[model samples]
Target: MIGQVVLNSNIMSVNLGLGVVLVVQDGVAKVSGLIGVRSGELVKFKKCGVDGIVIGLLKDSVSVTILGSDREVQQGELVERLYEVVKVPVGYELLGRVVDGIGNQADNKELPIELMEKALVEVKAPGVITRQPVREPLATGILALDSIVPVGRGQRQLIIGDRQTGKTVVALDTIINQRTNQRPVICVYVAIGQKRSTVSQIAARLKQEGAAPYTIIVAATASESAALQYLAPYTATAIAE
Candidate 1:
């Protein structure tokens, strides 16, 4: 759980988890793979005829290798991943229309099923779409900006200018456009070296304009942890996806 784990190598056995062992007993002790357990220097668990052991100290998905006479830890056991957890996406397209959050099929009144994979904010468009032409115009949500500079869908708009030239303002306006158009694109703002007051102010503004649910902000001015800042966009993207 800490660094990297290879469960396939030390797979003792596979279990139906029906209070039974699926392997041949070697001696007085019988080890069950249905025991979802692990062992550190501190704790371990077992599912034998003794008192049911539940190791509370180790992290999730613990691995254990019990010792017994003439017993061997086998491999290639298929541990069923039949987890009960489920995640639902906010936005899903149906028919010919789009929708906002809360599982409403705003487009064609079609019901979306429980998605197996969580939605991602950003993903590579299908390979077939990669070669499509950028013919559709993407309104950047600002009248003044778009009148001066228009951005088409699949367009890469590069904002290159000196400080205080409204680079961030341009980005915000584009995000705002999505909400108005009913194709609300999620925004993940990574504010590097930004003032704390400025970040707070912008967050407040976004929430006021009903953009907080689809908006995520990460600022590097507060924490020294680089990992936090690095993974912030991916988290936001996953939520949007």
Candidate 2:
């Protein structure tokens, strides 16, 4: 079956099936008659002009989370399964730019060059045999941290504290310290549920400290839809990998 694809306001002719919106809820929507729908597939609501991703599959319906705005979607609207999953631009071109969860350029600056490489937002991890041990330390440049709680490469560490604590400051400092390190590392900072101003300040700080060129900021600010916030971390991790 043939389906119409609407991308960034442009309609492209492709062979895919279309589903009809059966229900709509807060950040969630249900579509019927999409037999080929797959998890993570991008779906566009024709009437509302919003994008969503398939999150669940029922016997007769597909559950989706609208990416940005979902208030305009209603029952009986046409939902086109783009057949392609959500992808993010991955190349040197994105190093210093701010992007949303789906890798759309958030900065107003025009891209200097076209991004030729795109990576799927969802990916599987490398097998155990392909991985190495974490013996090398990733210096944070903070004397207290380096001395007390040294982090190793490939190690996952969580920093938790009360509000107004220096959690963000520590992360920013670590990113900045990588500039002088002998080993090269690409950093991706995912900011979820943060205020827009707060994320902007963090991006500005990274640029000022010369870390922007080696870092990618994925932001899903507090004002954005819940779906974006939920996917921010996964998107950032995919970029880093």
Candidate 3:
């Protein structure tokens, strides 16, 4: 079982963690006195109510990217290791809902229904022998593209173009089209570094078009912390898988 430990330098113990903020940069904190902490592990500033992710391990200190406001975390504050990796909630109940990069509800409604499982943001891919081959065609409901470049079930297709070229529109349309598929297709829409107004517009459109029932919107808006934008895609992949 995993146990929680509060590190106090004054009263050191084997199970207790010892971490002190040595430096506070733009959005990262150099913490000292932490032992046996791994990269990607979550940590928190006890007095600031801010969490961080360990990004680099130095000889005497660990570089942690602050997940919230860095200005709130002061130097010499106590740092506690959560002893857990970054994770997000996953379940069918996430459908038709909106969440932030860390899986917090963003729709201004009650928390997402029945979040029965949590998945690590980063995980190893399945072996080839255990994975299904990408043989079946997956239509995008776009005539020109379907005629020119066909997409397969398990294929990675890139939609590349200059700015304002309707790339997002195409992707949104594809998600809308999945509503008519023979088998139900769960869709996850991830918006990274986008404006909150834009995300709200997309959500409204999806709901208006009757596609919101099976779609999950994961948003890390530009107004939020950069850590959230960095975690947006990984969180989406974890939930989708």
List the candidates' TM-scores in order.
0.42, 0.86, 0.91
Ordered by TM-score, highest first, the candidates read 3, 2, 1
Which wins on lDDT, candidate 1 or candidate 2? 2
**Model 1 lDDT per residue over 1-241, tens place:** 3112233313433444322222322221122333444321111122321221222223323332221221332322233222222122443222122222212232234555454344543355567555678887788877876788778776657888999999988887676567776766556565654566777777667767776666655454443223223334444445444
Which residue runs of candidate 1 sit more than 4 Å off their true CA positions? 1-133, 218-222, 233-241
RMSD for each of the candidates: 14.1, 5.4, 4.6
Better of 2 and 3 by TM-score: 3
Give the best candidate by TM-score.
3
Sort by lDDT, best first: what order? Answer: 3, 2, 1
Q: Model 2 segments beyond 4 Å from truth? A: 1-16, 112-114, 182-184
TM-score of candidate 1 versus the correct structure, residues matched by position: 0.42
Error of 2 at 133 (Å): 2.2
Clashing pairs in 2: 3-16
Worst 10 residues of 1 by lDDT: 40-49
Question: Lowest-lDDT window of 10 residues in candidate 3?
Answer: 1-10
Expressed as tens digits, the lDDT of each residue in 1-241 for candidate 2 is 1122123112222234777776778989877767767888888998778899999998767898999777788876788877799877777777888888777777887754354577888788888888888989999999999999999989889999999899999999999999997754789899999988998999999999889889989999899999888888888887787
Q: In model 3, state the lDDT of residue 66.
A: 92
